[model samples]
Target: MKTVEKIERKLPVLKTRKRVAAYARVSMESERMQHSLSAQVSYYSALIQKNPEWEYAGVFADYGISGTVTKKRDEFNRMLAECEAGNIDIILTKSIQRFARNTVDLLNTVRHLKELGIEVRFEKENINSLSGDGELMLSILASFAQEESRSISENVRWATIKRFKQGIPNGKFTIFGYEWQDDKLVIVPDEAEIIRWMYAEYMKGASRIEIGRALMERGIYTRQGKPWVDSNVKVILTNITYTGNMLFQKEYCEDPITKHRRKNYGEMPQYFVEDTHEAIIPMDEWQAVQAEFKRRRDLGPFGNKSLKLSAFSTKITCGCCGKHYRHSGKRNTAGEVYYVWTCQTKSQKGASACHSKNIPEKMLQNATAEVLGLDEFDEDAFSQQIEEVIVIGDDTLTFRFYDGHEVTTKWQSTAKTDWWTDERRKLWGERHKRKDTNPNKHLFYEFTGFIKCGCCGANYRCQSGKRKDGTPTRSWYCTGPKDQCHNPGIRDETMKRLVTDVLGLDEFDEAAMDAQIENATILDHTVTFHFRDGHTESRDFLDKRHGTPWTEERREKARESMKAAWTDERREAMSERIKKIRSEKKWPNP
Candidate 1:
């Protein structure tokens, strides 16, 4: 227990000798107002020091800040701290509203200062906090000030909402990839390149995580000169602003009293302004991206959010614990934030389930590409290289790999590769096997190889892919018997329709494909094979010789002969077929 410090000196005597401090606040830090604040501080210090009856404590002014809220005004808080430290006995301010426009805040703060023997004087209000009944009148006036402040805030919001409904562009945050000249966005050539790269990568089936890494690797930075991040890339992908359009009032204050802003997709009228700014992404590309985003969004619960590749997620596979890593974002300078992938297992279980590990988004993307055997995601280069790999396998058909190794264009190299020995063939097959089993698998050329009727000598062109159109005319067209399989080979498109129909894949998009793959475990028995061109053929492998002249006797003899044959030629053919079958295998788990 300690004895209380008594006020041995009376207020009249103290008022004549006590150090007096003053506080002031200005809403903006304009040159003129800054000068005025400085003058006030100097004047008070000089006036107090010159007076023999008073001592100069200090003049604290919060410049370029609001007085309505004391929380953000550091200068005011410092003065309060000084008072608590027993450095000053009195505080002088311009008015009650200036002291604090918040009624509750004003009263509580003044009452606190008074208890520490620090009296606050509102010169305009002609009231001192320590005087009897002075606080009662101050609270009533402060309440009026607070109410006035609320009225101002409401008017601002109403005006903003009105402007939003009118499709007016408002606010100060500048859009990246565009320069604002005369209040309109114009494409900044350099920044626009980065934006274009983002959309291009995304359209080429790169995920947000991949896009972020690509940007960082290219020495590209955000509008704020910081490293790229997945969430930031996602935002860039989703923002219609890059399409030269915008939605005004996408978010609004959820709590009018507390002023908490939230997405107002349901509550407010959304205004879309198209071609309002110069485009960073083409309208067609933007449409494609948005279509993809909506398709992913419709996947529900298991949306593309989970598809994000965090740094740790790509490299670290859970041998026992199967939980995957997750990603998170944080704000940095320039009001931008970066995202990082982290081990969600550790985050949730606190090292019980897994260890805490994090990886940068860029690193993950590079690792994934490398794992997928696509060390360089240069589309042209990849296309050329893969084509080169395919051409060396067969020469009679003139089938060209799009990987730039066109047999016709690079015939000399193709001829050399075709002469690969048995050992070389085995090595090539092994390399391809490794590529297929890579965990960071990319969906490039997952469909490919073989569509021919052996009996007709009719080499049908088996298309392994299709266009975006929802028709079945795209699959295997009998180029006609070079040409013996008389049945005009089915359309590649028709093959996809037939296979999808049988597999119940009604949705014909990447998202649908992803879903089919995910549910593959449940439908693992519903086997099928997808061609490199995106055509799917059932894995039933039935021997249906439609074009063969198969009399009953000949058919029986062929089957019996096939069973007994074990020559080196037969073995060689079987080896090639086995290699091809393994090369063309798919999860079919869906």
Candidate 2:
């Protein structure tokens, strides 16, 4: 055996100090509470720094912020962030209530800190969170604190309700036309004039939007120094406070924890105090404005001065869906605007939702004239006598009059003859005439109208474009609505290759293809060729545009070029182009 020798190694040992942080908060903004918060901050700072084993990590103090929810406490959140960053080994707070009044929030925070191997020392409760029994004490004490907060909130709400019942406002509110002067509402002269002008314009049949626009044009703004809006105008018009009356508790806080303010809306009692302030407008004029508001509301959307009024705007209703009829218009081939009334449901959700037909505006006028015993339609007389026109079934109209009399009339649509005048027919013919001027149209022109979409059974239309290298490219795609058919477009080269392969030919021969095949159907991945002998042949086709010469590097370069080209201005222009296309297609706004 070899001789064994013992070797001792000496290494220097470094002492580590615990990083200590403190948190302090006050629930109210009173001067006394502010002083208390300051005192707590100073005490904690001195205490942590003076301790030999502790490395002071600063004191976090939140002034006049609640402890129930930690979100609102900025300093408290910062302290938690520092603790999570391993900068704190222990946290010193006044008590569990100061840490958090919410039982769940307190228990969750304590457990999270404990898992991080950090201890929280509550001076008032004399408990260390890292101890086994500390969590039980915190839970019981936190529940008591939460209950105390609830009792305080309830007492405050009771006091507020008592004040409301005595016709006293809870506090001074910010109104546009008036300001609080020594506990009383006093109207500002300039603002009062603007308020009077709003009422006058509304009485003169000017819409709230029009008034707001006028105010903006005059450089006038709301009390918040923002441009006036329709809602601002409406609030000024309907405010009873301007007539020296006060309405209390129009809105109230529903809960103490969430602090969500909800409209009263019969959920609570309201108190009204008359002669509470100097009147801007007389009570009689205010009542008249209210009556005008009611008249306009009863007349429906067209009654507002914003929309142009038509004789049958709100007077026509759908008998099938019980929805109001909406007015729509389009220009005929002769450039003449023709209007029609359609069901609201059918206009928005398409014919699948409602089977209502569009009634021509002219037909409606003729029917109304015939029912009213007039040779021509009279707007004034119709407005005064007719209440509503319900389109029942396909060709029947039931007109209900205000005098409790109803007339059922059968109508026939003459749209074919009415819309297709001699001039319109000539224009339509000219418009539909072959207008293709593509030099390479012959390459794919034979396939146009011969290839049908397998998904929607619509004809395929040929489109031509030029590649970056100035080489012309043609493609055939389905003409069916995109929402109904998603058949992919096929390149002209791919189509010819497919045809050649199916016929077992050396190259594409148009005459041979025309003589042997009747038509072709384009599916998602395969094309089915219909032969003249009543047989079909299916062949898979690939998009040649995605094949050879376009390597990964080239594709990446193209992607980078596209990204560079799509700037803010280009994005905005693309958005506008899409909007114009959707409008032309008569699609519903998204």
Candidate 3:
């Protein structure tokens, strides 16, 4: 059949054009380098368009960007994105160093492109990244480039160190009160005036925060036109450069790749060049300010410029935890604000860390006055006499004197009674008066504030809820932390009956109870009643549960309700939840 046909058919082959893009970069910013970059972009654009087998994919050029890191190069990243999108078949670059100076980055990028069926052709080295020996050649050449960059960085650092030894600045810096002129620091008249004022204020005992506030009020800002802050003010106050001196290498770049600068705390050599600039603040005044800073620092927390120091601040120490006492103000139940000194450990970490009790400011003053044999507390006299007040226990203070004498005094805190004035007591009575909505308010409600837990010394909290039989139930328990107190809860009916028996009343009478009883304390199995006439009576506490007793009929109703609630879906969900919990607990199936 083939011999008979003897005819040949030809098929036209379609020529597919390769999409090509080029990348160019210059490390440094300059007019000549910018022109070079422009020429490179133009040449690559024309070269790609002129080639018949190549389609013109845009040229990506990064100017004044380091090739060691590809993240900062926007156009280079865009070209990579195009290659990943299967748009660019080949990437043309001037050299491997121009693509990436980092050896690992170069290899990783090239291999990634190769996986995407893209090729990178370096014009200068005549290397194709898709070729068999591409990665080996790229690794060797990129290592050379990285070494070259490191060598250049080291040379620059050496030159800078040499200049530092000669007391020459590495470069003109942007200082707050000075400007760079002719490669030298020159004083800016207006900013110099502000700096001078800041130094004067600091010498006059004005705090940095105060100086910053004054500057903000006057609408005076930093050289960068930002509002002056305490930190900025402190910088001006402490900077020795303002005294016509310069300190170089206070910070140094720790890494060439990350460019992380670390503060030089004797990690490297520092050069302090005097008379490097005109003086904004005189040297003598600057020295005085530094001395004052040291004095304040030695004073500890009392010297914090923002805090108004009290006579007791930094003067009291917790004997148990050996930590300073922190001043904290608290509002009592009567809404009266009073200050107390608490151990810093207890205040910050909690009572578990330090079990020191808080001493009221008034109690501390009274104890100091008694220890000094003074009729009244005098801060000036106390400061002159007492070096430190050590809180020994809950109610004792040990005062150490500067003259090497010590005095121990027992002091009780009357802060509770001191807060309860006649008016406050009347207000409290009015606040806790029973509302008319409750039918049994007169019976159990009258015992609310009167009943206290002896275990934790906390007022009992009244709780009311409905039982399973839909009957309302009331009980009283300590308001203290449940884990710590362990005081048993008492039924409302039990408490009312105990009070009635203690008052010798035929039935519960709120009026008579209030008239006779001052307060009542509940201890373990005992209820002690303090009478208004100064007589105390004790009765054994009866722990009785008050609710509708669970009868056979009620049990049957509960069982029927349980059966109704346990549907097939609910049972399955319950089974799954139990299975998950058992698995989490690593328990074997039962």
Candidate 4:
């Protein structure tokens, strides 16, 4: 045994070559990022190919893509798939954050590779997966990476808030009436005119829907060169920005994972920077618009009422429950429409909230008319003399005068069915007909003026076309240069419906809508309306594709159709369509 050991000689141990792959990622889309990403790819590729003990597997690189999730990283996923197929023995990547900002994603991927007897080498952290303490170290480091990502996000949010606090524009944020010039909101005169016109129109009783349609007719397109809608008109009427004030943090991201933005609504701190720039809308006018906005909301159930001067108009209130008495339409035996006021709670929520009696509109008018010493309902006189009428009981009403006098009266319901004459019927029918005849009348808001293209400052005009059903359809078209502004017109009615929905109003006030809205700006599929009331709202329009989304069966049929259509030559040609197309992975993303 001693003689055999003395004769033994050391020999070189042969090493099995590793199939090595490298991955790289860059999160930004800037030119600098492109250079950085290219450098990373080149570096990793050279490093892997030059290794003597490693067989070069293809380099995987994801550009302008987040490392937080595996879903969006196409190349990263491809590399993993190759590893799962036993094509790769080792993978080299930059660092934990570069690989994945999520700890779970990093741990799971690393563990999966480990189970396949593949090693993951983190170049920056100098970590190897096969080591005993590798997983423990990776878990701790991955946690740090995730925390760093969160910290970066928080820092960005905090910076934005700090900029808002300082009343400094963080970046080029612009509205229709203004452009971001040197980080300042500079007013565009023509656009400002449109803003003023919108506010005036709304204040003059134009509804948002009507205003959107009117803007379309005037060839005023949105920022992205789309048609105007009611919602667009409403947003203009409500946005405070036109008043030279900026409201920051109206929304906030709820979590770092989903990046879901939620409306501020007291969830986070909000910053209001007053007098930030020259105002397109006067502050007083904006305040008036807000007051009107609230008043429109107060309309609640009555929806829109005729602008007829009457003592019964918004005069009754429930003193017991402190709720407004809503006007309800009723039909008589004569087939005529009459009206009565009931406690809103009783009418909407049943009698459980307010057990009050309904008051006839005619009776209320007569009582108010008598109290005001007028033969008819004089809104001016009533406003000047009597402050509010409080309903203590179904039949009991207390009229509180501005002079501090309270008059209690017992009101009895009377039949005013005779008031509905054929003439009155014509008036009501006219209002309804007016809504139907005006194509611009697509929305109930019916406010005119506003909505322009943000890019070219051009107007959006209405264009008519025939649908497949052989029916005529109206869409908005931009007046901007087609090559410059790639905006497609929106369906007029679609915008109107959206605007009406946003305003939360029932169709009635054909004249009242113009008095509230400011102006609307369109971009992409969204319309942002700046309101005279210093509030803003958004409306989205999506094109209605003729076909539904493809199902599994439909997709298979599509594949078969493609197979049938493709010849050997065509398949070869398709294959030559370059990896650039594959690299440009976007929506319809897998």
Candidate 5:
């Protein structure tokens, strides 16, 4: 034991050291700055690894990242995280500016690293945060870095503003019809043809949707390879760029801090560069298309509504309830098809539904023809009545402003002179109860002025009903409410047939008038009717039921004839006596 104590053994000491890391950030990838950042990373890595007693950790570098604040610098933040986790005991960076240019960020981060037993060394400043007097030195150095950053930011702002003022465009927003080549607009021939076609077709009266469909059917896509849309067509039509002009600064981006992009409008200055690019659409044509577009838009809903149908299904109405009868053309097993009108209000309200009658489409058409005196036996009167009815209907069906509502005000029935109020129809069932006393009374009075509902003393004219097949059937109906009357309107087919018969037509020949017109030659108001079945008829001006080539003398004569026809013989004689002349041979001959 004494010998062992007297002997001293030499021991080898092993150094236990912490890993170190270096972080570097460059705001931009300019050639010189990029090389500088790379060199710093290499230098720091070698310096840490070369020490015999210490081990090399790693080096992190972030390019195109601002060093003004440590918060936004990814490499710096990652290094800090590692240091806080006790993996890194020291951090080396090129300079205070390279680490962080903001004094607040630098001081805060250094204080944080100090608490974690990690030290930060600024090479250029030759200072270490872990040193006893490091805080005082760091404050002075960080202030210089922040001032340098502010100067750089100001210079960048000045350069950007100067470039903008020199009429230089920024960013790389692509334009249609033209491709960018060497920073200049060059017309792509294929796209230019399509643009020309669009403008030409539009000015020639083709609609936007029609043009879009044509382009789509041809598999021609837009500059962005997107399917053509009507809105895009409209944009193309409105863009002045197609007319060889360029507009800049139509939009603005406010300061990032404020976060506002106010519209330039006319208040802000605008830059117009004319003839900067080849023209795709002519100016005159573009202007014309714009005008037409405005016109179509002004037409509102009517011009754009579907034009798929033209038949009795579109015309039949409920005589008693004042609702248009809906139609169904599907043939049943028996090969019988029907058109009927329904009460829309009742369908939604269930048990509280209306008891409106449904009549076939033919019935309403027949009724219209008969009331207008258009039957085969009355050939002359039929043609005359058709023309007169067309004139009156067209005149009556006009738009009018009523109580902030644009209403389609029209005569519901020509024979009865009943005007339909759209607002009244919409509010009908909601406010008023159906009168059971005279269910059909209002039908004849309101629609036909002749037919009357037999059961409830209501006018019997038009009513819509639903059949077992869920199809609407329209007919004249009792004016009574759903709880009161079951009277339905006459079948629209029956009315049509009767009216056709009244017109003296053997059968329903829709092409009769058209064929007659095609066969006859007219030099103004003269027309001759030739039936397909070999019957020919002619009417002179005096024999025409409706006044033609309307003249004051003809009008007066028609009034006299109507007066004589409407009054009794005794009153007629008195009218004839009061007239100046009965038969004048002094009248001019045509």
Candidate 6:
């Protein structure tokens, strides 16, 4: 063999150069940090180029990003991807903390890289990731880094709350009418005047909508230069800040990882600093405003009708349509104003949707006066004592008193016109030139308010048609859309058939039914009637929720949320929990 290899022969085999990349990061974007990051990039580039056995892959740097989260670091993710693609042999980072402060994330990433035959070398730690003890050291050190970050966050939060307790504002925060000057809230004169006017107007019975409209009409914009809406006006009115009071800890960050802010409603302590700034509204007036707000809210739906609304206005509910009767006025040419309450659903959505007719407000009040056993009921006293007036059918009124007493009274129908009737035309028409300015109103069915809509809980209105002979024909329907109600309307004839046949009622007596039935709720596929005796019954119906298909945006959002929920950190935590549980207990059999 030696004698045969006398001639000179070359046996050197070419070796591929190791592709090396570097990663650098700074948590904050300070001037010093920026320079440090730039220096790191330059150093890594020079170091890789100068190495004969290594090839310069790239240098990845993230600025103003936290080292704890790997998801938000763009450059770091890119380097990891390159390493997995076999484009990089080794990753050189300043230290383990610079790579990742989260121990789980760092360990997972390092283990993943090791499996792919890629190495991570921490310069400061002088640790090679390919070594056996690298991960154990990395996990311990990274955990310390995570704790350090948490400590800093906790300390900052503590300082903020401490300052808040001392009535010293932590930082400058801008509001509509005030600016922070040297940690003191100083009101802008012009804005303060606007706030004062708003409070005054609200006390004078102007609604938030009215106040907002007035501001918009005057071309007055909010501090943010946006058109003021009702909500904005309401916020300004409700804010105690305008009353020279400052409330702190109204909101808080949920955690450092997610960094989501939530309204602090009893979740934490709040500090109230009174007279912290110049008052836009006096203390007495603010108290009065709160009392008024409570009064309106306690009254439920009726109190929200109108700001300048008089006592007892729109306080009556049309039982058939489940809508508050709207107050209407008509002139009688005698210079007298005749007020009547019309069904809102009937008026807005038309008679087809709601057949509930109008009721004379004056006549109804007289009956109420009689029920209260008073010679004459004052509007103020009546409003205070009366909880609500539910008008069923055309003439029946169910009055609920504040003292928990209920009274049902019947009034003469105003729809039956005596002057226009053919039988009485000869007698009364000749006296008034065959025309009566005032006409009687009569309802076709007494169940307009008696029978309520199972869907919207509104009263069933009486729908009648006039035959050639002038006799009445009637049916019923729901006017849900007019009242912004989602439940579909049911025909009165259908309800009557269902009630009389199933419940075995005599004349479908609403008064008797009202005494026995608590409520009737309708869903997509069934109607559940709750009786006063706690008995329940359900009837099948077609499902309605299967209308619209899933939207593209909704589908995409679901995918992204699913991915975010199964993050590496969350996965590791779940895995470790499972491992601990497995080590603690073992099942004997399936």
Q: Which has the greatest TM-score?
A: 2
Q: Model 5, residue 344: what's the lDDT?
A: 43
TM-score of 1: 0.49
| Cα-lDDT of candidate 1 | 0.63
lDDT of 5 by residue, 1-590 (tens): 45544567879987887688888777887999899888878888888888775567799899997776556667777877777677888888888888877788889989988888888888888998988899999999889878877777667656655655665665556777887887667888888888888888876777778888899999988877898887898778877778877776676644322224676787656677677667877778778878877886895433443322333332333333444445546553324454443444434453245555443344445444545445523434433333211112222322212223322323333321222256644444322222222334343322232233434544444566687789986554445565766544444455445434534797755444334322321112222344556665443221222234688998899999987787687787886665535435444433
lDDT of each: 0.63, 0.88, 0.86, 0.78, 0.61, 0.76
Tell me, what's the RMSD of every candidate?
29.6, 22.4, 16.8, 29.3, 29.0, 29.5
Better of 2 and 4 by lDDT: 2
Candidate 1, residues 1-590: lDDT per residue as tens digits? 99998777656544458888888776677999889888877766776688787788889988887666678889899998898788898888888867887777798898888778888888888998998999899988898888877787789888987887777776755777887777777788998888887888777777777788877888888879888887788878878888778888878766433556898767877788777766777778888999987876685334445364422323333323545556677553223456655555766777667653454444444433443366554444433333221111111112233343333211222222433568756655444333243333363322222233434433344455543675432344444434334444444344344446655767444434443432110011223444444555454322233476679999899989987887788899998887777768942332
lDDT accuracy of residue 154 in candidate 6: 86
Candidate 6 local Cα displacement, residue 439, angstroms: 41
lDDT of 3 at 480: 85
Q: Mind giving the per-residue lDDT tens digits that candidate 4 earns over 1-590?
A: 35544566789999998899998898889999999888988998898888899899988999888777788899999999998798999889898888899899999999988999999999999999999999999999999988887888899888988888897766776578888777678899998898898888878877666677788889999887978876677778888889989888877888775567898889798888888888999889999988987887787423333233345445678876878777778875335677878888888888887888888777877778877778887767876888788887657778989899888878776653556568867666444433333344666334223456766767676677898889997776677899999775677677677666666767534344445555567888888777678898888788775567779998999999998998999878886574446667532424
Rank the candidate models, highest lDDT first. Answer: 2, 3, 4, 6, 1, 5
Positional deviation of residue 308's Cα in model 6 after best superposition, in angstroms: 18
| Per-residue lDDT over 30-149 for candidate 3, one digit per residue giving the tens place of the 0 to 100 score | 999999999999999999999999999899999999887888999999999888788999899999889998888899999999989999999988999888898888888889988887
Off by over 4 Å in 5: 1-10, 68-86, 101-115, 130-150, 171-173, 190-243, 247-270, 281-590
TM-score-based ranking: 2, 3, 1, 4, 6, 5
Worst 10 residues of 2 by lDDT: 432-441
lDDT of 2 by residue, 1-590 (tens): 99999998978886799999999988999999999999998999999999998999999999988777888889988988998899999999998878888888899999999999999999999999998899999988999999887788899889998998888898898998899999999989999999999999999999889999999999999988998887878888888898999888888878766567898899988889889899998899999999998998897786687876597877899999999898887775445688889999999999999998899888899899999999999999999999999999899999999999999999999888887789967666544422222334465476755688899987788898998999999898898999888888998888999999999999999879888998899889789999999999999876754555678999999999999999999899999999999999998998
Question: Which residue pairs collide in model 3, if any?
Answer: none
Residue 193 error for model 3, in Å?
1.2
Runs of candidate 6 with Cα error greater than 4 angstroms are: 1-14, 70-89, 104-118, 127-131, 193-235, 283-590
Cα deviation at 317, candidate 2, in Å, is: 11
